[model samples]
Target chain A: MAASASASAARPLAGDSLTIHVSSRPQLAMVSALPRSSPPTWRLGLGRPARLSTRSPHARSVRCLAAGGGLAPEMRATLDKVVASHKVVLFMKGTKDFPQCGFSHTVVQILRSLDVPFETLDVLANEALRQGLKDYSSWPTFPQLYIDGEFFGGCDITVEAYKSGELQETLEKAMCS
Target chain B: MGVTKEDVETAITSSLSPSHLVVTDTSGGCGASYEIEVVSEKFEGKRLLERHRMVNTALAPHMAEIHAVSIKKVLTPAQAQPQPEPAADKAQA
Candidate 1:
């Protein structure tokens, strides 16, 4: 019980309630506990969705997703597909390594510090994406965040969430699934 | 030939009926850059991004004349207030 508790604290967010836990040695039980809805299953992104609960690394990569920032019907649908493409996605001012704006840089730092895998779209490179994103989120700013294919908020909101530890929890959940 | 800040503000006011409105010419002498802060009932339930879109959509026709537009503050009447830095005084950054 103490070992489980320590593991929980170390992770604290990912793969908790969302996944059914099983020990490595008990291979048969882990295989049986796998959800019926889960795909036929390969060990690709998260190493067999069945073992997601026990492993932390797989959960982290699977959570990166796209931020749906396209407002038109066709573009909106495409963006929806993109959000599901990765586990975490950020529509930012610059690329992950070189942020063009201060606000975009702040978000990049937050994601980096968390050490979670994330994908970024550089709005600065494309005028249509930039303008369309403004319409899509209806927030007149760059550096927007999307979790689980939903708009979480922008730089200020991300900062506030980070301060209150909510961002960590959200990211943990994202990483878990 | 050129668009004025008042033109932009008036269009937004008519469309969104904001509680407060401020428009500034950021282009020095030319009507290129503009900054705006709008507080409106329509902004309720909408995020800052959405509010800015409404402004952007309303001004889409003048995109040719307007170059840099910074939406400094977008809030409903309840959320809008006298912050330490008002949108009127914010720098381009």
Candidate 2:
């Protein structure tokens, strides 16, 4: 609590609680609102209304496929750097020649059909990168396609984008850069 | 025999100690495509990509049996919440 005061002193609050500290506030409120004898839901109200933040907890359960790589914290940072390293990168299940997963194969096919040149990371070989990717993209599914070092979407999104020619357009822009 | 769902769960639970965990059999029964959602302290400070990597690593032994693994979400218990609809998804309708 004391640390909060120091932090608050540095930045003025737009609301009762500082926006930066909003998440922490909910956790704290949830702690104190606990009545030793009351029902759990009563405690729920006192805390910050559960936020449906962009990052959802259940995001990873979107598809039931096994991840292939090991993603350590440092490896995660490295992966981020790597994704940012290239203009176009895809964290796919397999490589361009032999896609291990159907979703991955779909994206590879789409990329090829578009005549786009992109780098692919085979998560199967490395464990750390695979696990780290789930968190980095905030996506629950695989066949994650990145353009200009940014996550475009998963296989489904890629397929749709390819159909509409958006995927080709985006890749064209990336390749030129 | 390929890796089983129970094997994947055990690896994840043992590695991440997630507060919430959901494992789905996308393969229908063959154990190929699978999806998982895990909320754990291990995910704190890590980004979405990294969190996925962690889950992937935990399931390494079972990877051969898996075909398409989709991670719907990975978050710290504190960060865990329902997902927001993507802007494109909203626009498409």
Clashes of each: 17, 51
lDDT of 2 by residue, A1-177 (tens): 111122223122112222111101122222222222322221112212222222223222212222212222222223334455456677777777888878889888887776766677777765445655665554545778877656777775676567768877877877776
- Fnat values, one per model, are 0.08, 0.00
Most accurate candidate by lDDT: 1
Scored against the true structure, residue A56 in model 1 reaches a CA lDDT of 30
Candidate 2 C-alpha error for residue B6, in Å: 20
DockQ of each: 0.18, 0.05
Provide the lDDT at B59 for model 2.
77
Error of 1 at B44 (Å): 3.2
CA deviation > 4 Å runs, candidate 2: A1-73, B1-93
True contacts kept of 1: 0.08
Tell me, by TM-score, which candidate is best: 1
Please give the C-alpha DockQ score of model 1: 0.18
